[model samples]
Target: MRRSQRKQEEPDLGVLAGRTLFGLQRELFTRLGEVGHPDVRPRHGAVLAYLDEEGSRATDLAAQSGQHKQVIGTLVDELVELGYVRRQPDPADRRAKLIVPTDKGLDHMAKSDAILAGMEAEHARAVGEEAYAEFKRVFRLVADRHSGR
Candidate 1:
């Protein structure tokens, strides 16, 4: 069939991935709102995604999240004000500060983890665990390829 003549039944893979993630984030934000974080937004997910259990410097987070230092700094300030994250002097370097998740942030992380786990379990049940595992492996391979690993 000619390119123009062929019907497009679904979005391309990139669109599918972006839309699916957006939907998941919407669901997460809604759940968080229900759990007492009505102010949390998907934009903050960029900062939250890079934060570790131990903590990291704002520059590192900005690099990982592909955001400007000023932007990440502002987001960190907001997160601090919201009680989701705190800035503490980095022991390794006093000149730098580490962005650490507060107890509230960790609790939110736990809840978010549970929500994703439930979604994964539901997907596995629908697709079969073996198939789901294979899918995960394939996805990882694709990611590794993109990362030149």
Candidate 2:
């Protein structure tokens, strides 16, 4: 059949991925706001999602998030201004600064973890646990391909 004559029954992979990511982020941020971290946004996920409980270097966050160091720095700055994180000297490396979560950030992190778990559980329930597990496995493989993992 010619392209114009063919029916578009389903979205392509890129569309599906974009839709999924946007939907997930929308739900996450909305939930976060309800829990009092209204300043958290999807763009901050690059730093927030990869942050460690102790602390993390901006460079490390950049590598983990697949963002540039400068971008990570900017996000850290924003988070700092939002009172979610602070820059402190790394105990292991005096020359480097670590992005440490404030008390508010810690609370936000804990809430975020619970919310994401609940979301995943809901998805698993909808799709069946085994199918959801398989879906995650496949998605991870596809996503990690770009990271050379």
Candidate 3:
């Protein structure tokens, strides 16, 4: 079979997931740029998406974001420089620091939440709410099963 013909076959789960993730990230970052966060890049999502309002430790963020601790540290430093996050002493442990989002980061987080909701609504509308819900449920189950979580 020709390479072109092989390429035309239905995509495997990895290809489909990667393509979907790419599209979602592109749309999300573009929308975020329009909302006064032009400096926020797709890579920043690794930190922002997993962050909590109360703040979290670098180790926790690294585990949640599936990024190396060094990478998380670099991203946190960049965010601090960008005025999106600040490091504060962890109340529970004076020896540890917590990554807390600034006001700008909170605003960005709200906007991102709304934009993602709208995107999900659009998809649900296109494919029916029930079907979309089922798709998400199945996808999450498979993801969890593979991740051993």
Judging by TM-score against the true structure, name the best candidate: 3
Question: What is the TM-score of candidate 2?
Answer: 0.93
What tens digits encode model 1's per-residue C-alpha lDDT throughout 65-144?
Answer: 77899999999999999999999999999999999999988887787778778888988999999999999899889767
Q: Against the hidden reference, what TM-scores do the models get?
A: 0.85, 0.93, 0.96
| TM-score sort, best first | 3, 2, 1
lDDT of each: 0.85, 0.93, 0.93
lDDT of 3 at 76: 94
Which residue pairs clash within candidate 2? Answer: none
Q: What is the lDDT of candidate 3?
A: 0.93
Over 4 Å off in model 1, which ranges? 1-8
Could you tally the backbone clashes for each prediction?
A: 0, 0, 0
Give the residue spans of candidate 3 off by over 4 A.
Answer: none
Per-residue error for 91 in candidate 2, Å, reads 1.2
lDDT per residue for candidate 2 within 37-84, as digits (tens), equals 998899999998999989999999999999999999999999999999
Error of 1 at 26 (Å): 1.2
lDDT of the structure predicted as candidate 2 = 0.93
Number of the predicted model whose lDDT against the real structure is largest? 3
Provide the lDDT at 18 for model 1.
83
